[model samples]
Target: MKKIILTIIYILTLSGCGLEQGSYLVGWWNGDIPTKLSDKEEKIWDICREKTKYLPKNTEEEKEKADMELNNCLHEKGFWD
Candidate 1:
């Protein structure tokens, strides 16, 4: 039931497993949990967005590098790491 599902989410959230799990719980719960970004995360978000914008269009090499950079950024930020 709903209570059981919520209890499982609570346990996983506390265990600090990974962001995907945490994101789903918060997102699925419609922001039941706080999703505030820290100052550092805000800065990284800006950088990543800017970098994504400047990636060369119609260039395979540039696209690959951009993809790698984005992945690296996310990993560094501990999202998909």
Candidate 2:
């Protein structure tokens, strides 16, 4: 059935599920990836804030970058790992 085929494809895709940086320690490299995160994902959020602290003031681009930065900063120095 079409449904069965779609399900198989979905499973295959998720089988390789991974965040941007590929791993947590490597998180800082991408600035928009979260790898090896734990239950305390909040900790990584804080670290992202610190890493992007020096970025420019309020702006769409800055906000977008911050969001992406958070994706990768979660496991750097916070309790997320």
Candidate 3:
């Protein structure tokens, strides 16, 4: 009985059966983060590197929004002709 219960618990934990969508586990599993920069991306990265160092003190949500805006700007100007 103990082995059976432990096995069931282990499977449930591994499956993330009851986890919320916004949990950190979900974010990590989604892998939306960029890990490397292409040449073009590097150019945009250089252009934005200074801005990244100077982000203003703000709430977490506001900072995330600012980062998203910066990423959108980089995408628009870097890849779009």
User: lDDT of each structure?
Assistant: 0.74, 0.66, 0.74
Q: Estimate, for each residue in 31-77, the C-alpha lDDT of model 3 and write its tens digit.
A: 85435677887787777666564766389887887787678767767
Per-prediction backbone clash count: 0, 3, 0
| Tens digit per residue, CA lDDT, model 1, 11-68 | 9788765556558674766766666787777777777768676777578888888888
Residue-level error in angstroms, candidate 1, position 18: 37
In candidate 1, residue 81 scores what lDDT?
26
Better of 2 and 3 by lDDT: 3
Listed in order, each prediction's TM-score against the native is 0.37, 0.32, 0.45
Candidate 3: count the clashes. Answer: 0
Over 1-81, each residue of candidate 2 has an lDDT whose tens digit, in order, gives 999999999997886576444566355655755456554665565566778878775999887887667665654455433
What are the runs in model 1 whose C-alpha is more than 4 Å off? Answer: 1-47
Candidates, ranked, TM-score: 3, 1, 2
